[model samples]
Target: MNDRWMQGPQFLYMKEEDWPYTSRENYHAISEVVSVIPTSKFESWGKLLRVTAYVCRYMDALRGIKRENLALSSEVFQRAERVLYRHIQAESLLSELEFAASLRKVAKKTAQCSSIILSMKPYLNENGVMRSMSRINNAKWLNIYTRHPVILPDNNRATRLLIRHYHDKFRHIVVNEIRKKYFIPKLRQLLIRVRKHCFRCKMNVAKATPPEMAILPEVRVSAFTPPFSYSTVDYGGPFDIVHGRKIEKRWICLFTCLVTRAIHIEIAYTCSTDSFILCYRNFLCRRGTVRKMFSDRGTNFIGAEKLLKTT
Candidate 1:
């Protein structure tokens, strides 16, 4: 029956029953009768767009069916058409697209089944058995086995069961025999190199380095202002010469005159505590005694600081 009017009228009737927008003076009267329905889960704009497209396609398909005069038998197509029309009235594009895509998937599955039946002879039996060559071959083999009953390799008959059971073993035996007959013996073989750890040797070589600390030259020590007068002292350079070969590691002593802002940098042969102390004392002698100095918390500097405090 042409029940398209149900889409508009029924939708309006249902909305009225729910009393969705009746919050005026009739609010109490509406609320007494209307139970609020839960909102729809499909709320995304993209989903709506997809559904709309589906409905459009389904409606197009229904139009085609109508043009061909095949609407009577195509019940599903008709239902899809009604649904598409409803979605169109609702202004939901995504719902139409989603439904159309679903219908297309069903059509594709039906086509696939039809194709399979066409390709395979005696396709489906009345009992729903799909007749194929492999099944027919197995049936023939069973008939032969029942009559003859010969003692093959597996019970002396090269049947499907025996073939399946020993196929992999038979394949390996054949390949190995072929290799024995044809493979060259005197050829030099390329061996693959595999890495393996020698546990004993690894344990023997596992020794820890001495805990000698060498601070990087840039580790700055904050000096207190005016009331606390201290200069920041740190190590400097691994300097690169224009001609000399670059050293992997080198050390230089650095002293900053906090008051004068005069920087003293000396290349250190070794960053020993004695060497650092000598550098600090030399700075004090050259440019008046600095009562306090700030430097990185390295072993050498800490030791020098302690020695200066004692003196």
Candidate 2:
């Protein structure tokens, strides 16, 4: 249907009702109908473009179909959609791509006069609609849409509506197939807008990105340090240990070196300050004195630390 555009009316499909631009008066009539839309919902053309970028509400802008009808067959809806798309391209995009179409002649070609549309090999049909030419013309196995796709304006109202129309149960995956029939600029941006506005998908399907971890502290990164030089102490459980015949509960004081991750332990029979002082004394004797000591604010540890500072 698209490759036949330059070949004239012979290759084109035009039914009586689908001819939105049968004459000058008829085309204006259709445009006027579309222009007479409610100003409240669409404050300006910009507003319409923004709204349609995700979800479209301008269903009856041209009164092309009776949307209020209870049941509309998929065939009728698709046909009306094709008519609407062509009408939209005729209204705005055709004029934008006029220079690109004129570039078909080598005489009109200029290095200074370049357009993005020209890169897509854009051409104007009999109705002055811009459609892009594809390199897959020799592949008879492919469909007409794959051979020549219509070049649509980026973030336009018509383009938005078409994207929303195809956005069904598949969600974002449909963008791949949409490339087959339309040459919309920044199509990924359009898909991003769709994803952002789609509340259901954003809430349920979107994954959270974890933040990066911070750098290690000086104590953990320091090298060439003696065992227990930069060390932290903590007291663990009252494990049962048999002393002669009777079993006794004992607490273990643990010391860990930050750099080398060396462990040293001392047994304290009770949780009293005297018992902890004896246990810390034994750890210092075996593991050597710590250059920096780190420990929780336990009363027993605090008392032992006060004595060590006083000494």
Candidate 3:
């Protein structure tokens, strides 16, 4: 090959009409360069070439547009960048597939006749062989065997790539997709490991631990205490009461004994401080004065407490 071709494609003073010829020449030069590189580097080199082409196109489009058209130039550059980014992502996926394929090959050889398995022959039982019979029947199952015997291996990088491709779906979904072609041992564990490390999945995962239960107070747990020693008060309802031709609304104050779980109900015509005080007086007369009282922090309860304290 000529030194000019070896030096790679260079466009200098080229006319618009020469683009077709120049592109062909560029392709030829790229092929020559690619032939010398290792197979592993091919995907990366192809991605670089695509990005270069996109940048060149972007520059060419910008050249035709006026300098005053900043918006158009920005838009063109952004679109080109997006395309380049996508190409890079695709190249990464291709690399992952290649690595997984290599692992699969190694695993196949190991499964057929591995020194590791022979070493563990003393420990393997008839049950083990019977359990592995299904796996042994299928050559595809060999993909799970790696350098070790008891500890099965998987292409974690490839599995993660597949999971991300499926938008980080549940373990069962990913397992189903993988089982379509290859058998991966502990697939659920593998998926869980990937998802646990995934930033998006971790952020979206709900906390597995439940909220701690509040500690029980002394009054609720004390044994053999009097029924009205400590009481909790709450209001319930607006029941309709019919007297002759007139219908009226009534409310009930519920006083629950913290020790004995006993409840005392008092009637109130209105949810007012005076009405609540009367109800409290009735409760004191019937169940005896409570040493401690718990309430729902209602306005009527607060007003009644202040009135009782003053009286």
Provide TM-scores for the models.
0.31, 0.47, 0.47
What residue pairs are clashing in model 2? Answer: none
Candidates 2 and 3 compared by lDDT, better number: 2
Candidate 1 residue lDDT tens string, 76-141: 443433332232322322322232234455534444343322232222223222223222344553
Worst ten in a row by lDDT for model 2: 49-58
Q: After the best TM-score superposition of candidate 3, give how far the Cα of residue 298 lies from its true spot, in angstroms.
A: 3.7
**Local error of candidate 1 at residue 15 (angstroms):** 42
Which scores better on TM-score, 1 or 3? 3
lDDT of 3 by residue, 25-84 (tens): 443322122233233333332344444444545455655744454333455554443343
Model 2, 118-140: lDDT tens digits are 67777666645567777887998
lDDT of each: 0.42, 0.68, 0.56
Query: What lDDT score goes with residue 241 in model 2?
Result: 91
**Worst window of 10 by summed lDDT in candidate 3:** 124-133
